[model samples]
Target: MRLRGVLLPAAVLSLTMLAALPLPSCIPQSTPPQPPPPAQPPPPLEVTNPILSGDFADPSVLRVGEDYWAAATSSEWAPHFPLLHSKDLLHWEVVGPIFQTAPTWSEGNYWAPELAQDKGRYFVFYTARQKGGPLCVAVATAAQPSGPYTDHGPLVCQELGSIDGALIRDENDTLYLVWKEDGNSRSLPTPIWAQPLSEDGTRLIGAPTQILMNDSPWEGQLVEGPHLIKRNGWFYMFYAGSACCGRDCNYAVGVARSRKLLGGWEKNPLNPIMKSNESWKCPGHGSVVTDTQGRDYFLYHAYRATDFVYVGRQGLLDEIQWAEDGWPTINGRRGPGGKVLAKPAAFSEDFTSSSLATGWVWPNGRQPTTSVEAGLLSLSPPADRAADPIGAVFARSTNAGNYTAETVLDVSGLPAGMAAGLSAFGDPENALGVYVRSGKVEVWHRERNTHEVLTSLDAPTSADGKLRLRMTAKDGQTYRFAVSPEDTTWTEVGPELSGAYLPPWDRGVRVALTAGGVAGASARFDSLRITPN
Candidate 1:
């Protein structure tokens, strides 16, 4: 066996002798690894067709068994406190306005409405204020889903300065109400309060206790619209704070949680769960619902098109996931630095009937029962609002860029002034309709509260009351109305509209065939459609 000799250099021996020198404790260390670029925002709801597209603001939703019901504020708009129902959450149909038999106080006071189901009865707790008026809460109840709910008087009487009253029931079956109020107007910030409800769940049984004070910059000057829920032994309150319209609007939803229902609640370390600026202005006033699968969702309203004449508040729904710490995040947007998830599904024409589509909505809560056969839809005239008309077949506007509305309608057997036409109705001064009036097919435009007859033709009228008409819209405010006896023979009766978009009092545009009091006369429609150019 050969033994190898170890050779040590003189410098190595001297360094070893210099001994083990210790480093200074004050020296800083290298930065910790960055948190994997916050897992990219989950994709937006892949909504090929969004259910709501016009002024469906401050929405509140409830999922009862397999059916989902929703309500929204309808400020200054007649047929107030509208309610909508859905089976898939993706396809929603208008059930009825909650306050069809609304009280005298309900006229100008349509605002945020919260819905709840107790026992077998449905309850709608809503708020409203007159023009330049004070806000108050009212309760309405109905046995069936679609309601002609009668008001149960004031939830909180006489006292003013309260809105957005949301209800929640604890595991112990104790009911509570959370709402916003300016209890201290000047010094302290606007806050949210909660109290136990009476055993009946119609009125408050205890005094309101302050649950949270606005402290977040995203909360702005006001903290309102409080909704509470319990999960995992913690009570979570979701609220929207700040104005939510136009350039100045900076609205967002914030949350706080506590182990106890009454105390020790903490403002979420992360807030402004949802927000938008400029392009998607005013994203606030949201509500959450749990689906049958136990998944959570956030239903909110946001402004898409700044064209006040064409667009206002629109409903947006996205999936929500809760953090391990118990705070919920919308579409997984992180604080003020998140993105809105796209809508969840595409609109399908599967449930469509020639007589009525899911998109149709009637003003003042009245819809005409119609006839559908062999691809032809016949609308019977409604008794009331005969001058204004009753039924409309509308789809949510989907003009991401250029907005165009083109449709084919046939007007035969139509009575005089009972027009076969197309119109867009939502905004104050945004209407462009083409129909047969006074025995002639004519095009009319209403811009920002003014009406104009643009063009007309001596179009043929049908003894059978059927006509084929098509109307096309472009930009934000231009339209062209065309008519035809059949799909092949099309004629232009109106010139390119310059300033028509949405007309006041018209809830939505559809193939309107209203009879102006001529008995045995009605209008027949072939096809109606809108295409954004």
Candidate 2:
């Protein structure tokens, strides 16, 4: 949908201007203009649920002074770990990533990053599976929250698998790292463990102690994504359990408390504190943070049950209050919804700047040839990388389930086999897109090794060789494609495409501009407009 300002007709404009001119003696003055309607208290800030509307999961947040910083799992989508910054808990902007490139030792499956600051240095502890190896927790250090973080090496590794690492500082200044011992494959219950860390926050100091394991009936087959916070002299560990992906995903967050940092823990009778409700499904993997005013909140992820599961898990936020009995409750025991919330302090991004907008990221990092200038983003397909899952793409998460994304592409320069257009990408195999190639525009969908062409139409001829493409996603389950020679009018190109085939393993669908083929092909895209419907 296009946004335009209302305009006045020529005759109406003339009369209105004349009426305002010399209303002097002609129109009797109204009785002194009555005090401006008491200023109507500027409509309450309507913050929306899922403050962050896209596939950002396993959020770990920390409040530093007045600023809040967060990091989340990128899995196989690179740029390593994603970092977000906000002045308030309600709104966030992407501040690039923690690692500019994947570590040499790890190939993919980077998940669950926890950000922490010790002494004065910032550290990020995360899980990465090395090529042909097991999943392990690793640490990286940077002077700033969003970093060119330097890998400090593995912090926790086991023969089976170890993932989801969280760091907490105790009252006595002791630092401890908590992580999960993955056991889903062996049919054994997954367990949480803790180990002390050195002063520099680089390595573990002693042997690990097992904290808790999957014991509740609702926990399904695993317990992971452990986050620890201290309240009222007690250590509270919040974790996610049950199946984390797919149509029947039963993921939920449960809490366990302990008097001692390492042992003597008891699960709350309430058990799963957060779970799926009518609107959002699989709500779990949460991290808690307190605002500047000391109000507490739970930041987590959940899927829109009505949308295709491949839409991924979007970021959600809910207010939490401590009960008289010292237990925490989320949104008065209600789940996520479309209800209006109070807006956080205002934040904005300038895409015209040389730096990429804080809301945009390149999945699996960016190719050296990818560059952004002014408002135009250009990408050159890498040579011999046709088989890469991520290919050459620059994407940003869909902040809402229903939205319209439009872009103007100059694909004239693309080689014969090269293609460029807008796409809803989950991975190389699972994507729905409308691409321009060889003087033709085609709509296609891919699932794993199968690629199907839904339709193709002749590319509209333009003097400048620019094509305008628009994609509308409804409830995140279906997509429609349209094209235009110019931005003003559009023609539907293909039938509505179903996204039902998208799988949860592909994570959430990233709306992106993609350029790829056999090497030497490049595409320039500009005027990208993403609007929520």
Candidate 3:
């Protein structure tokens, strides 16, 4: 579960250094000391099947020269379309969000971001809901791969909704953007449409063409998430089908190929090339990235069967092997089986830094008023606290199936009726947590519009007025809450609670720091420690 470097002992290190040097030429000529064998290179790191640990669904990966970069669907969360970078594809570090905030024209509902590069410019073809319009495909450009990207606004907001904007180049080097018409929403047929992009790859210049549609029995009600890669003179388009979200999802990857960009594309007889196995379920909505050695790999998302859909659809990596027919197979067509995966190290964040970490997000892409100053994180009550959910909330995705999240909140300064606490939040509708008020601690659960206090007790703060809030979940379902004073002992605050009501069908639970109630009601948190069990 833990990874560490093997360090040589000091004596062994000194001897190894001595062996490498010229032996002074006088000490033993009769029996020349043999040079130590060349030090073996470190073994390659073994990354897990779900390469990204959290809710990184509908992942698109781009390999620009030597580095590998990825962007994922952010849904209603802010800092939409988080970009991650990796050197070996085994270890990934978050580069940052492509947009620091949502575009002025879009409100929320971000999904299916595609990462691409052309003409030395890095472009992100992403999906978002326009303010008063339907779901649309938008574009943003950055000079450097790790970006301060400039938003170009929505390109296509079809009557039925347009989503999953993928880019490709034809034999004539003409750029094109392909996306899905979201007819499945109204129980109509969905079509994959392609249109030529302007020189800048921004505007839809040419007339649109319907390249593919939902016609096969296996594809269910829709076909979407089209990505193109050319091999041996054929343009192979990889796409997904069926309900691609929630517990009812039956997603799978299918492929079609054409010699021409907009015509004569034929779906493979073995239409669905990738399907779920015992380990992971409903795998689809991914992109193909060829490595430095020209080996092709598929980066996609799948819900872990062990944790089911509770942890969200995590980003998974599978290799694409070309069969004798030039078609690709993922996981050797065995699915992303139960292979051993590496777990990231547990970390703690104290409010000593000036800026918040990259993962914190708010509901519907709207950030609440918050700040970190003088080694404390202060969350202010929202100006409009009329919403049914907690007034001001900041949260991070939990990657582990079982984990414990603890925060040290300086609750002494909180106003009456205004409480500071920790939460496992699925949306504005669903959450479970414990909060500290003036004279008592209350354990609350929110499902949809209903907010119920599960339990309450007259527990005051510590002598120093600090209270530690702790929330734990096991098997991604059962949850428990506890609170402690300055001491190490934790007192359970509520009955063992089930998290069945917390996770929505699409996203995972976010371990959050919450402040709610009337205006000027707030508290400062000193630190947050997340430990995976």
What do the candidate models score in CA lDDT, each in turn?
0.61, 0.77, 0.84
Q: TM-score for model 3?
A: 0.89
Writing each residue's lDDT as its tens digit, candidate 3 over 1-533 gives: 11276777788778887888986866766766799999774442344677888899999999988999999988877778889999887678876888878899998788998999998998999999899989999999989889888899988999999999999998898999999999998999999998999989889987999999999988999999999988999999999988887778899999999998889999988768888888788999999998886677888998887777778888888777788988777766777633545564565889899987777788874467888998899886567762333777888888777889999988777777777789888888788888886578889998885889889998755888788889988988888998889658889997999888778766888888888776755568998888888
lDDT of 1 by residue, 319-434 (tens): 77877766788755632222332432222232236445543443333444456666665655455535542233233434332444444444545566665556655432445566
Over the stretch 360-410, how does candidate 2's per-residue lDDT look in tens digits? 556553552667776666777567665332357777666555778888887
lDDT of 2: 0.77
Clashes of 2: 3
Clashes of 1: 36
**Pairwise lDDT winner, candidates 1 and 2:** 2
lDDT of 1 at 105: 57
| Lowest lDDT 10-residue stretch of candidate 1 | 503-512
Q: Pick the candidate with the highest lDDT.
A: 3
